[model samples]
Target: MNQRIRNCAAAAGLLFTAMTASAANYTAMLTGPKEAPPNSSTGMGAAFVKFDAASHVLEVDVAFGGLLGTTTAAHIHCCTDTPNTGTAGIATETPTFGGFPLGVTSGAYSNTYNTSLAASWNPAFLSSHGGTTAGAESAFAAGLASGAAYLNIHSSLYPTGEIRGFLTGAAPPVPEPASFAMLGLGVPAMLLVARRRRKA
Candidate 1:
C-alpha cells in the first residue's frame, strides 16, 4: 500500500480499538478456585468469571469435580480480603440467566454463568456478590475505579466462602481508564490532523 494509505489504515485501527474497549473487566489471578475444596464435601470445583463492559454482561462459569447429593444451595458471598477475616457481604438472590440462576448464594446452585444478571456492568456486584458475577476484565476496571469489588465462592460445606479474591485489577489488554480515554480521543484527533496535513 502507499504511505498515505498505510497511515490511514493505522488510524482506522486505533479508532476500532477504542470503541471495542468496554467499561470494566477482570480475570482469575491464580487458578485456585479450580483446585480449592468446595464449601461442602458435596461441593468441590473451581469457578471462573469473565465480564465485558461494552456488552454490559458477566459470565460465571464453575467447574466442580462433583456436587452434593441433591445440590442444595450455593451463593457468592463476600468476606475479608484475606480468607476468614470478616463477612463483608453476600449474594441474597440471583436473577435467572438462560434457565439457570445466575448466582452464587445457595449451595444447591444450578451452575449457570452465562447470564446478564445485572442490566448493566455496574460496580454494585463487587460490593455485594464478590466472586459471583463476571468479575473479569471490565468488571475489575469499573469496580476499582468506582472503589470496592471482589470475588467469592460459597457452599453448604463452607457457608461463608471457600475461595475469594479481590477485583483489584483487570486481566490485561483492556485499557486503563486514562488509556481508554486518551485512545478514545487521540485516534480521532490524529486522523483529523493527518487529513489536514495531506490537504496542506
Candidate 2:
C-alpha cells in the first residue's frame, strides 16, 4: 500500500466511526394540568433532549412559564406506566435541580447527565429499575421510545409537580457494524481504482 492507500484507509476509518456513532433526540410538551397531581394553574413547559448512545451522555434543555408559584425544582422521570399519570423515579443526575436561590415562576433549565456515572441516577431508581448507570440508561431510553419517560417540574405551590410531559420520539438507530465494514471496504476499493487510473 502506498501513501494514497494509507490516506484512503484513514479516511475510511473516520467515516466508519462517524456512521456507527451518533446521538438520539427526544422532545416533550409539558403543562400544569398534565401533572400527576393535576392543577388548574396556567403553567406550561417544553423540553428537548439528546442522548448520545456512544457516550451515554444525556443533554437536556427545558423551559417553563406561567406557573402559579415560584419554581422550586425539576427532573426527568422514567418508567411511568402511562403518559400524564403516576410518578416514577428521577432519571437525571439529581432528584432536585440546584442553583436557584429564589425560585421564579418562569425560566429555562439545562443539564447534562452522563448515564454511565452512578451519581447521575436517583437512588430508588437504581435499586428498582437498574442496578447500574448503563442499565438505567438503557431502561430510560426504552421508556422514551415507549412514551413512558417524562419531564416533571416542581413549584412552591405544587411541591410534587406543577407541570409535566412524557418524552416522545424514537431515535434513529446507529448504523450496523457490518454496514460500516462494507462501506469501509468500498471506500478503499474506489480509492485504489482511482489511483490506478491516475497512474495509467
Candidate 3:
C-alpha cells in the first residue's frame, strides 16, 4: 500500500481499538478441603468469569472434582466483607448454566448472562442492590473488583457449600488521552518513513 493509505489505515485501526476496549476477565481456583469453611468436607474445583462492559454480558465457566457425594447446586456468590470468608449474601441463578443438573459429582458448568436480563440474576441480589438490572450489575462488578466475590459449589452432603474460592482480578485500565495522541501521531511518522523509502 502507498504511504498515505498505510498511515491512514494505521490511524483508523488505533482509533477503533481505543473505542472498543472495555472488557474484564477473572479467574478463581476452588480448593475444597483447602478453603472450606468450618465443618465442611474438602473438595476441589475452578471457576472463570468474563465481563464485557460494551455488551453488558457476564459469562461463567466452572469445573469440579473429588466431591464426597453428588453435587446439589452451584453458584457465584458475592459481596462478602472479606475475601474467602463470611457467609455469601447473594448468589447467581442456581446450577449456573441451564441443561446441567446439579446432581453430577464431577462435571463442568457454564452460563451466559446479560446484565439487563433480570431473569438471569439472583432475586436477592436485585432486591438488595437497586431492584433493577443495572443496579445489580454495578454492585456485582464493584464487589468483584474488590475481591469480595467468590464461587461456591454445594452438594447433597454439604448443603451450604462443599468447596469455594474467591474471585481476584482487575478490569482493564482505561487508556489515557495522551496514549491516544501518541498513537495518532505515529501514523504521520510512519507515512513520512514510507515516503522517504519510496524516494530512495
Candidate 4:
C-alpha cells in the first residue's frame, strides 16, 4: 500500500512539472480610456504576446483601427510602479517596433524578437535592469506577469499614447501529446490508489 501511494505521488509530480515548463502568454485590449490621462480618441486596439523562457524569445501581435490621427509609433513599456495603472518607459525597441506601420490610422503587425539579443531591447531599459540580456528578460517577464507591463500605440494627435492596455496573462497554449499521455497514466494510478485505500 505504501509503495503504491509513492508511485502515484511520483506520477503526479511529473505531470505538474511538465505542464509548468511550457511558455507563458499574455494579452491586452488597447483603448483610449486605458491610457494615463485618458483621451477621447475613438481608436481601439488589441495586443497578444508570448514569451518562451527556454529560447529567450518574445512574440508580439497587434491590431488596431478607428484612430483620430495617423499612427506614429508602438512599443512595450514595463515595470510600472503600479499594476493596471501608471506609466513606464519603453522596454522594447526605440521609437517603434521593427516593421511597424508608420503614418497609418489602422493596421496589423506581427513580429518575433530574440530577447537574448541587445537589439531587441531599449538601451536605457537594458542598462536599468542590470545591464545584461538575461537580467532584462527576467525583469520584463516579471512585469508582464504582474500586470506592470503595457503595449502602447502613439498617434500624431496623441504623442504620449492614443491607446494602451496593461498586459495580463492569457490562456496557455495547448499541451503536447506527451503531456496527455502523462495525464492518462497519472490519473489512473491515482484513482487506483484511492480505490485500494477505500477498500481497506
The top-ranked prediction according to TM-score is: 4
- Residue-wise lDDT of candidate 3 within 1-200, one digit each (tens)? 69999999999999767645655667676655434464445456556677664677887766566667778777778798876577666556644545544777666656678878877778898888879888888888888878888877777888777777787774223334543243343323433443353233
- Candidate 3 TM-score over all chains jointly: 0.72
Give the TM-score ranking, best first: 4, 2, 3, 1
Estimate the Cα RMSD of every predicted model relative to the unseen true structure.
15.2, 14.5, 14.6, 13.3
Clashing pairs in 3: 32-43, 33-42, 33-43
Q: What TM-score number comes out for model 2? A: 0.72
Backbone clashes (count) for model 2: 0
How far out, in Å, is residue 128 in model 2? 1.9
Alpha-carbon lDDT, every model? 0.38, 0.69, 0.66, 0.81
On the 0 to 100 scale, the lDDT of residue 96 in model 3 is 52
In terms of lDDT, the best-performing candidate is 4
Candidate 4 Cα errors over 4 Å, as ranges:
1-20, 170-200
The TM-score measured for candidate 4 stands at 0.75
lDDT (Cα, tens digit) per residue for candidate 4, span 53-172: 567878887777777889999999998998989999999999799999989987778788999999999999999999999999999989998999999999999999998989888632
Cα TM-score per model? 0.40, 0.72, 0.72, 0.75
